[model samples]
Target: MRTTPVERPTVLRRRSYTWFPVVSGAGFYVAAIALPLEHGDGFASAILLTGISYFCWLIGWNSSFRFTRTHVSVTNVLVTTTADWRDVAGVDIEGGLAGLLRDGRSLDSIAFGGSLIGEFTGYRTHRRACRLLRQGWWGAGPGRRGKGPVPVRTSVEWRRALAIATALYVPVVLVQGLGG
Candidate 1:
């Protein structure tokens, strides 16, 4: 577990995929052994079925990764790569959150949950990080050069909408408070 300096958490996560392993194991156990369609020498068939099921599950498991507040972690069954958010220059959301760094290297965030690439969904987490970077909460370290350009899309629009909505509501509340 690498350490980071980010004090807040962004929305970067890949949770919808971890369930694939669980579902495959359970489905195979229930279908092939627990309640076989036909009862006749299922021992050999069950072993093969289990092998295939676990293979698919393992494949899904190894491909998922996540983003923490200060770091983005990409993992495989054997290796995991982590990059600090401070080094990111921009986040390209074409197919996934591709973090472009000031050093000219880019990392592809784990895109699971049918997130446009059949498995690349970290929309919320990506948005929060964009918002934080735009707010300067997760960017270049002082005295040290890091931080890149603002992501193409930032969360300020959402904040603006919220402000407009609040403005509309406050006037109504004020009117009610002064009148009979």
Candidate 2:
């Protein structure tokens, strides 16, 4: 038998959404400086607005679904959940793209917009993303490797970027407490 090389993970995200975070972050940063200077809200307000800008940038830039040979990882605003191919029961597209686990847990994906937004737009985007995820799931299923059902092992990790963004607001709170 021939030995094959390991494959790299495939990441899925909306290309059209790439401009939102940058534009919004810049807008918020400008408002942060302008509001405090024009309206005299003090440094606390400016810092709080800057924190919100960082939060938007962090969430928009870091969230996506990554599919590897062994598992599928869903990255949301702060938490990332990775489920093995054998642990995933199926894909749920009713709300958005979600992975239903055999252990009765569901990991929601941020790569697709929610159903509320889809209700106005007709769910075309959600359907297409769901199809891609389902294809990856079947392509990496345990049956293809001749493996039986194994114990469900789902792992979760909180991204440090979120903590950094949140920490931006601490100085605002401290400044406000000092009666600035």
Candidate 3:
């Protein structure tokens, strides 16, 4: 008899929202170039527009959730955190999949996370995504009983990537505010 080996972790993403960013990013990128040419605007407008485009692209392409037998990794717009199964108290579905920690903290998810408009419209995808995440959490059994430390670490690389995106807006804001 042959036993099956463990497979890869399940990855969940908001595939439906992908096009919004692509279109939005393209629009902003066009504006970044067109505004500088037409209005002869300073670097501020270009910087702001390009920053917006980068953020849109990042949200569309980078955010995701990976659920493994031992842990769950959540990648949001700003950060990517990996939480051990034992640290997860439960799953929260406030139009997205958020992990409720045993210590009363909540880690929000961007992938499959809905906007206020989508929530009001009662989008079904959030519920489905949450159900799958809940199943993975419960199946792991570590949340109830596990050994060793329950560590939740944020990826340094992801932090740096988001920091660069945020930095793009800061200089433009400072320059504009200083009357430059």
Number of clashing residue pairs in every model?
A: 6, 0, 0
The Cα local distance difference test for each model comes to 0.49, 0.68, 0.73
What is the model-wide C-alpha lDDT for candidate 2?
0.68
Candidate 2 pairs with clashing backbones = none
Kindly report which residue stretches of model 1 are placed more than 4 angstroms away from their true locations once superposed: 1-22, 32-41, 59-62, 67-70, 109-180
Error of 1 at 152 (Å): 25
Over 4 Å off in model 3, which ranges?
1-9, 30-48, 111-123, 142-150, 158-180
The top-ranked prediction according to lDDT is 3
lDDT score of residue 159 within candidate 1? 49
Which pairs of residues collide in model 3? none
Candidate 3 local lDDT, 19-98, one digit each (tens): 78968987987766555333436566778797888888778766778788888888876578888777888998876668
Provide C-alpha RMSD values for all models, in order: 19.6, 6.0, 7.4
